[model samples]
Target: MKKVIIIGAGLAGSYLATQLPQNYDITIITKASAQDSNSMLAQGGIAASLDPGDNPASHEADTLAAGQHRNKVAAVDQLVHEGPKLIQTLIKQGMPFDHQANGALDFGLEGAHSHHRILHAKGDRTGLALTTFVQSQIEHVHWQENTTAVELLVKNGTCYGVRVRHDPTGTFKTLTADAVVLATGGLGNLFPLTTNDATITGDGIAIAARAGAKMADMAFMQFHPTLLSLHGKCFGLISEAVRGAGAILVDENNTPIMAAVPKKDLAPRDVVARHLTWWRAAGHQTFLDISAIPDFPKRFPGITANLDRHHVPFRTTNRIPIQPGAHFMMGGVQADLAAQTSIKRLFAIGEVACNGVHGANRLASNSLLDCLVSAEEATKVIAALEPAVTPALPQDPTTIVPPKLPSLADLRQAAWHNLGVERTKAQLHDFHTWLAQFNYRDLVPTQLSPKDFTIANLCLCAELIDTAALKEPKSIGAHYIKEVAHESTAS
Candidate 1:
């Protein structure tokens, strides 16, 4: 049997492991605990065309609209069409979704959606509930936690395996496999203040890019408009679903700023984020006010509990201060609908693969749905491939110790200053130059440490983002250019 080594034990990797033929030897590697992924922090429900009155066509239209005409029509169609079936599979695998009195799945609304087709579990803890359920059922798969993949092992233009750093053993090892799937999630943590987990540092995207895989649309990063600003290593996310449920974006004086926009509170995330940015620059603090919402606790129990744990009462506080933070990357290892990358034996899914389903901007709740549909499709493709000869594992060196690399704090600062919610041609050009200099001068060639590998990957991914953003002259979606006089005048 051919062995498949999956990197990043998030929803895509874990769910893909289950779908692959059990006969294949599958090992999932995670940087932290199994649940330590951005997926677990996803409070909004999965977007699915499950309602009897709704269908894939409607979902596809909404997704394309949000993507600003940059999404591939066929990819969007496949994702929307495959979404409900995958949701059903999750339900069968013990994912408990909210149900109405008649035993039908209860749906919630989010920004840019034409229908209330988002399926949730327990108010707003859908991602946690789903992750918990999936982990419980995935008993047969081999799990290597506290391990990070440093580089791809490619030979003769084909991917063979991975070079990994096992933190617990304090050593490097090579894991050979017939096939490798990189599901390592987005680069949100690259910024100083983001809703993404600390582990989301673009490892998969960087490793694959270095291995010669083609990346696309990397400039189109999504900045979520409402992450809670807290002082520390951890911060909380205020769900965009709150806006979908009638919450208002207000300035310091509590005046509604987004009321003039189409869909009002339900406008796409880019519009909402820009409004907040403008307000903040105009010497006013911005916040999302959900105080007037009648069923606030019932609709968002997870958020309420999280806020209560921090001693902030939702009912008493009139507004929650927020700003745009890096939330999702719409581009990554360019892939087809089957999740197969340019490389023959390599595949990518979830946030790491730019399957063209999201285009320039992702619709709310579409991320979880993308994970399900792409994972299912990729599993089928991987199962059909012929097994290849396993390559020999790389040996760990004992003679020399690798030098220390920059801290996560340094990386966050660099990314935020250059690649956050807004951009400019001059800033991006300078960033690219700095990155090229760092790579050529600082990074060592051999005996690389985990931190060294991670920082290198981050620099590569950041360069791609900066390069792509510099090329795209228009302000669209979550990506905005400060110097552009008008969005129409750009590009």
Candidate 2:
């Protein structure tokens, strides 16, 4: 049997493992626990056109409109057209999506969507429900928990295997295979305040890039508009679905945050995030009011429980504090429709791969759909592939020892300051210069701790964005740079 090594058992990796049985033998490796991922923290749901009135054409149009027509036409076409079928497949696999009294699927609307097409389950526990359910349906697959992928075993433009460190053993090992699939999640951990899990440290992207894979759209990082600002810990995301379900963004004076915009609370996340960031700079606080949504506690038990855990009291009359924070990444190792990366025998799926499905920004709830659809389609592509002769794995030579660097907290804080919602050319230039000094050489090594590698990936990814921002002065979509701002007085 042909062997395949898959990295990061998140949403896409989990589904792909379940699908690829007869074609090959597969082993799933995750740095964190097998089921732990950004998908678990996903509060909203997947977007799909299951209603008769909502067809793929309409879904495609909504997705295209949200991405400002910057998305790859064919990729978006496939995602909207063929992605919905996975919803039914998942349902057959025991996905517990919400249903109405009439036994119809309960759909909800989000920003930049015309129809109520998002399929959610367990209120705000959509990602958890889908990932958990799909994982439960797996029959036989090799699973490794707490094993971190340190490097891609790419030699002469082909990926042959991976070098991993078993967390418990604290020893490095190499797993050679005919093919390797990278399904690592996003790079949200780069920011001090993000809605992503700690494992999302851009490790997969860095490994691919160092092996000469082509990257695309590094400048387009999307910040969620409603993250509850917290001290000492990660920012808790207030899901956009909250607004879609009748919650309103209001200021201290009870004025709607998006009063000037046509969609009001339903405006695209980039616009809303920029507004909240600038609003705070102007001495104003942002809040989400659930006064319009009836039975808030019963309807959104998860969010209510989260608020309660944080010791924040909420009532229909009380507005929840909110601010913009780093959320989704729209770019990575550029891949094709079949999840094939630039490197031969290597493929990337989920947030780590930039298939151009999301252009400058991604629409809300489209992430989970992208994850499942890419995995399902990639399954067919891999199943038909003839296994290549596995070469003897390369030796891991003793590389240069990296110097003790500054705290990762310093890197994340800088990224949040200069690479957050809005940016300026001058600030980016300075940031890029500072990051260039390290130049990814500070943390590149064969045998290092996972946290150090994670910090390296974050710095490298940030530098990529900073470099792109300098070259492409024109800011479009989430990569917005104000034309001009005051020099010393600007906050």
Candidate 3:
């Protein structure tokens, strides 16, 4: 049996593991425990064409609209067309989906969607439910918890395996395999205010880039309009589904802030979040009023429990404090439709792979769909590739540079201020200069501790974002410039 090594045991890895041919053996590795993935913390449901009168073409059009038509038309077609059938497969396998009182499947609507086509489980706990549901079916695959990949084992222009360290015992070992799959989540933890799993530090992307894998759209990140603002590294999220359910964004005086936008509360996330960003500058605090949803507590048990614990009121007309926070990444290591990266025998899926499905901005709930679709497509390709018996191991690489105790918190704070919901060239340039003092490009591909390697990668990821952001003079989707597109055109 050919052995495949999969890094990051989140939805993409777990789901892809189940999709491979029976003759193949699998090894799924995680940075920490299985629960430390962003997939396990997702709030909104997976979007699909599952409702009556809904179809893949409509879903495709809506997805294109949300992404501002910057999405790859081919990739979006695959996700929209194949996603429903995969959802049905899961449903038939006894996966529980929310149902209406009439026993019909209760499809939910979210930002920028033309129809209510999101399939959720247990309300806002779709991430938790989906990851858990997929993980439950694992049988023969070897699982490695508390293990972190320090580097991709690339030699002769092809990746053969990974060099990882078991955090529990600090044991470093090489896991050779026929193919390597990277499903590491996103870079939310790199920001001060985020709804991403803290364990996500862009390790997968960094390692792939160092191995010469092509990366794209490194600057396009989506900020959720309503993460519960808090003074913690990781904040809670108030799902956008609240607005889709008729909730409204309000000021302290209860005036609707989104009144000027098209579709009002249902405007695309980029527009709504940009509005809220400026609204905050004008002195009125923002909140989401879900009074229209009478059975809010019963429908969203996870959200209600969180709000109650934080002393937030959930009654009619009362508001829950909301602010934009680092939510999702729309770009990553570039991958083809089959999930194959530029590097031979190396694949990237999930949030870590910028496969062009998201384009400039990601549509709500499409991430889970992207995960399943990318994995299924990649599995078909991986099944046909023959595994190499063994390849020449890498020569010993060494770097003697001393570790710099970089302040991660300070970097995150700076990124949020300059590269958050809005940006300008001046801020990005200033940030770039400050960040350049810690550049360690020459020291990579050598022996470095996990903390050192992560700091290096975060700096690299930050530079990529700043450089790309500075180059784009026109505002588009989630990436907003202080100057409008017409102003740039006039200049």
Candidate 4:
């Protein structure tokens, strides 16, 4: 039987695994416990055009607008057109979406959107709910939790499989297959302060880029404006839906600062995040005040509960301090509409793949939709290929040993310092120079290690991010240039 290996057991990988033919021997490698991913951390709902008054065109329009017109039109069209069907599939698989009195889907709205088209589950745990449901339904799939894919085992321009390390056993193993799918999530964790899970260190993008896949738009990152401010560091995310639901962004004086913006509380994420950053730099504390919101508990129980856990009571608290945190990467492994990368026998999906559906910035809640649609599309493409003869698995040589690499924490700090939030030509140029001088020769050991692979990927991703940021002189989306005196200066 032909085998398929999937890296990362997050929403995209898990869903894609389930969609593949049961006859194929499938193995899913997860870096940590199966649930440790940005997908599970997503509290906001998935955007879908299921409303009678809404359609794919509106969804596409909103996504394009949020992406700053840099999104790939064809890819966005496919995602929007296929969104409703995927939502139905998830619903049919026992996803408990919020329902109206008549048993219809209860939709919510977010910024840069013209329609109330986001679908949620109980309160704000839609992603968790969907992931749980998908996990339960995956009957025949083999899951290797706590396993990390260290490198793509490619030879002669075709990907054969991966070298992985099983964390629990501390044993390295080769998992070969007919195809490989890269679903590892975004690079948000590269920043010191982000809402993403710690495992999101741009692993998939880095691996693919090193394996010769084209990368796009690495410069565009999306910062969520309302990450909850904690005493020492920000941890929890304050959902944008709070603003969509009438909560206001106010300064220390409790006056709404976004009141004059055209979209008011409904501006795109980049606009809001930039505004919040500016507010903080000007010696003002930004707050999201939802105390006056009626039935706030029932409406945003997830956010309320999370805040309460942190000893901040949202029900009575008049103001919650806010700041922009590195949230989403708008760039990733370059892929076509079918999720096919430049390399043969490899596919990229979810936040790891720059399908261009998101462009320079992703629309709120459109992420989950991209996962579902792209998984289905990629699976279909994978299914159409005739199975190539199983090449003899590459033998591991006793003489070969894997290279030693930097610790994850060190890499995280390095990336965050140089590439977080804002940039400058000189900073990027210096970063490029420093990166060139860094010794990657130490990364090549005779044998491969997962940590080694992860570090290698991190360096590659950092380089790509720096290179892209330097190339795109104009500040757009989440990319801001501090040294640019005027917006027109770059143009």
How does each model score on TM-score?
Answer: 0.93, 0.96, 0.96, 0.93
Superpose all Cα atoms of candidate 4 onto the true structure and report the RMSD in Å to 1 decimal: 2.8
- Reference-based TM-score, model 2: 0.96
Q: How many clashing pairs does model 2 include?
A: 0
Per-residue lDDT of candidate 4, residues 247-326 (tens digit): 89998788797887778877887777777777777888888988667887788888878878888765566677778788
Using alpha carbons, what is the TM-score of model 4? 0.93
Error of 4 at 428 (Å): 1.1
Q: Give me the runs in candidate 4 sitting further than 4 Å from their true place.
A: 390-414, 445-455, 483-491
The local distance difference test score of each candidate is: 0.82, 0.82, 0.85, 0.81
Please, what are the lDDT tens digits per residue for candidate 1 over residues 1-491?
A: 86899998888888888788878899999999898999898898899998999998999989988998789898999899888888887788678999988999898889889999988888898888877777776756889999888778877668888888888786777788878999899988678778888799898998888778999999998988888754433357889888877888887777898877777777888877777777777887777898767888888898888877876655777577677788999999999999999987899999999999998899999998888888889988888888887555344445665444456577668778788777777888887776665642244324665567667677778888998898887777656788876342111
Off by over 4 Å in 1: 231-234, 391-407, 440-446, 485-491
User: Model 1 lDDT vs. the true structure?
Assistant: 0.82
Query: Considering lDDT, where higher is better, how would the candidates rank from best to worst?
Result: 3, 2, 1, 4
| TM-score of candidate 3 versus the correct structure, residues matched by position | 0.96
In Å, residue 208's CA in model 3 sits off its true spot by: 0.8
lDDT value, residue 192 of candidate 4: 67
- Candidate 3 per-residue C-alpha lDDT over 160-274 given as tens digits, one digit per residue, 9 for 90 to 100: 9998888877778888988999999888877888888778998898888778888888778999889876443234899999888888999889999988777788787877888
Lowest summed lDDT across 10 adjacent residues in model 1 is found at: 437-446
The residue pairs found clashing in candidate 2 are: none
Candidate achieving the largest lDDT: 3
Q: lDDT of candidate 3 vs native?
A: 0.85
